[model samples]
Target chain A: MNKDSISKMITIHGVNGISLLNSENEALLSNIKDQQISEAFVFLSSVMPDLEALLAMGAVKQVMLKGAGQQNLSTFAHKKNTLCIQSDPLLSATLLGQQIRSAIG
Target chain B: MKSILTNTISLKDDEDSYLFHEGECLEFSSTKEQADQLSEVALFFDQFFSALRDSDLLYTESHIEVDHALIIANILKNGHILLTITNTAPHAHSNLQHKRPIIQTPRSLVSNKTPSKPLDKKPTALSESAQLAIKKILINYLGPASTIIFNDVYSKWGALEQPTEKSRANLLKLLAEELYTQDEKIKFQAKAEVILKKY
Candidate 1:
């Protein structure tokens, strides 16, 4: 959806940062400031194109990554942009994944 | 702020692009069934350790298994791969009143009684069909670079050559074993093909 919906749909309580990257892995929208958090997303964003390429090639159905610690990242790749969420790890990534999926689908 | 050392997983290619990353919080799962749901942790580390060997990041191929999880940590350029397998289920330890047989990874499934034929050719690029099959299996977890990783592993195995039904079947089995997929159709197809070749 629009810029505001991202905040409306995806909860950012314990989330360190969020970056809405384009197919080029460039952040079209983000609120990451801490250098580590910023570096993390930047490093994470770099893989969006290949993800898109995978989707383009009719490969996987979905792409998600659970990082170490309490942080987890769910990437919803699209033709235009990739929604990457850096949030607290949850019991089931299904809920957060669905929210981001529907919000950006 | 305290850093949560929750189960972690990372996938970075030789080109230095991290396709998947989940490292932010410090909370542990409170459920048992959901414990094994760490797709992020499982997929990344499995490949990360495997990648080290392919990229020559490690002196030799290595892996670790504690309980149901596997870990492969390596010291690379900027960051070292730290893969730790933790059992989140409270019952994982308690419920195991009786001893269970150990599980083996495909890499460890090396058979001793040699093949019918002798070694002849070096590892080559995976056949197009095999690549296509593995791409479909690995793309979800690995993304587009699945092709690249596939090539690397294929060449390393020295499994590639004039494509024979036996070799193709053998390659597919190896892949199916390494990559975790929930889809039964894919699993069934792999098994069926392998059996057909054997028969």
Candidate 2:
């Protein structure tokens, strides 16, 4: 595995309780249940409006919510060229972190 | 994926075994040979239903089975559990009163028993073994940072206590966290929860 690549960063957006992990599979941020898609987009747009620029600045990728069926959000993700992963509510935060790391690497 | 070794058979000649899943029909067979393949299938039913019960997926096993295939298909379609048995006979019959679907294997029998009260909708926490399994999966598959979120969500919802509105809320909260996080750990955990909830 490439150590430098492993250290890359990723942004995850969803409700507050969602687990967002960095490329290294580290828990970099998490949102509460009340946080919605609009809030996530606003946050991302404000912080990293230019996805390519963000990637150049050590951002490896972005993971967004695709809901349970992964039907609607998946299409949107594909259009935006973003990675969308679906998850259940009962999962632990740490597991999400590891998944991010593995996905990025 | 781990390969699990399960016991297939445990009966001698003339020994009879009966298999029943909460609401499913009873499978009965007099001789082990008479119910060989069917018994193995019945075992699968028992195991599958047992897992569902253990996970608190389905409250009562009251649904009657029309055949072994129906039971197997139901479980596979639902993806909740797996069952297997040594030997059994397949006996089909009809109930005159309610006209319910019934399947009677030689190893067991089915009756016209009414289902009990509906079970609570919430999912409790994971058992010690289940919790450990989750931990192992996280450590091995997810990384250290991801574990934190998983632990937080699990601590919040993964209880085996009585299912209630509060428990469901906690579970949903955990799921929302996983969706936002986009972590595999959360994904698998969420899948497990979904299975538990479905059953």
Candidate 3:
């Protein structure tokens, strides 16, 4: 990957089966909105219990869980430098996007 | 008993206008008129009384000594009406003054279900996983931040003391403020207050 390309993009991995795309064409992680994550988990767990296993396979650079709820999984991601965005999903995404864009520019 | 019909009923400024009785809230809202018309006010009271009568809920009205009765009466005097009614009961009178209302109804008319008994002891059983998760979450999120100095915030918040409508409102308000924006917090608080007032 070229340095310019790397500088212009960031990938967000959403634990608990959420995904969203950013402007740089980089694969944004799970698009689940914050308020919907709990309800989403209820559905996802019924289908498959191991969401973390599924997320680990993706090229998500950072993991953002909704709310302070992420404190449960922070230890798991600490080794990977998988920055945990503490705000609710939407607020985290917006803030993350701004931070990423600023870093790239 | 000579039940004196006082012209002005003193009501606290912050007191809820409508009281809930059974499963219904006896409230009146005027649409076009700046205030309720005397006839409209009379009709509203009539409906409330009629509902109680229809339900065979025997109640008695007693004079209350309130400081703001004249003030509230003035508000009602100018075309506004006083809408008061009863609310659901587990079958016993509650110590909460706002929760209990006086009406001219027979005691037998009330529901037969015994009022919920107060718990004798505080809940001490906590799921091991839940306790661990709470501790971990607190240490990770709030402990490091140190923005708040709470020794046992969760434990304190989780406890219930004489669960009244006012207490419930306070709990909900605290939760909303912590989790939501100012507007959302206000909306949540308002919704809780509405529910508490009704039943």
Model 1 chain B scores worst on lDDT over the 10 consecutive residues at B11-20
After superposition, the stretches of candidate 2 with alpha carbons farther than 4 Å from their true spots are A1-105, B1-152, B158-164, B180-199
lDDT, residue B183, candidate 2: 71
Leading candidate by DockQ: 1
Which stretches in model 1 have alpha-carbon errors above 4 Å?
A: A10-16, A48-63, B1-110, B113-199
Two-chain DockQ for model 3:
0.01
What's the C-alpha lDDT at position B7 in model 2? 29
- Kindly list the per-residue Cα lDDT of model 1 for residues A26-70, writing each as its tens digit: 678787665554444443344333332322323222334453353
Candidate 2 local lDDT, residue B155: 52
TM per prediction: 0.37, 0.22, 0.19
What is candidate 3's lDDT per residue for A79-100, written digit by digit as tens? 2222223233334333554554
RMSD of each: 15.8, 20.1, 24.0
Q: List the residue pairs that clash in candidate 1.
A: A66-B40, A67-B22, A68-B8, A69-B6, A70-B25, A70-B26, A71-B24, A71-B25, B4-B26, B123-B158
Q: Give DockQ for candidates 1 onward, in order.
A: 0.09, 0.01, 0.01
Fnat per candidate, as a fraction, reads 0.00, 0.00, 0.00
Candidate 3 shows a clash count of 24
Task: Please compute and give the TM-score of the first chain of candidate 2 against the native first chain.
Answer: 0.27
Say which prediction, candidate 1 or candidate 3, comes out ahead on TM-score: 1
CAPRI-style grade of the A/B interface in model 3: incorrect
**Rank list by lDDT:** 1, 2, 3
**Candidates in descending TM-score order:** 1, 2, 3
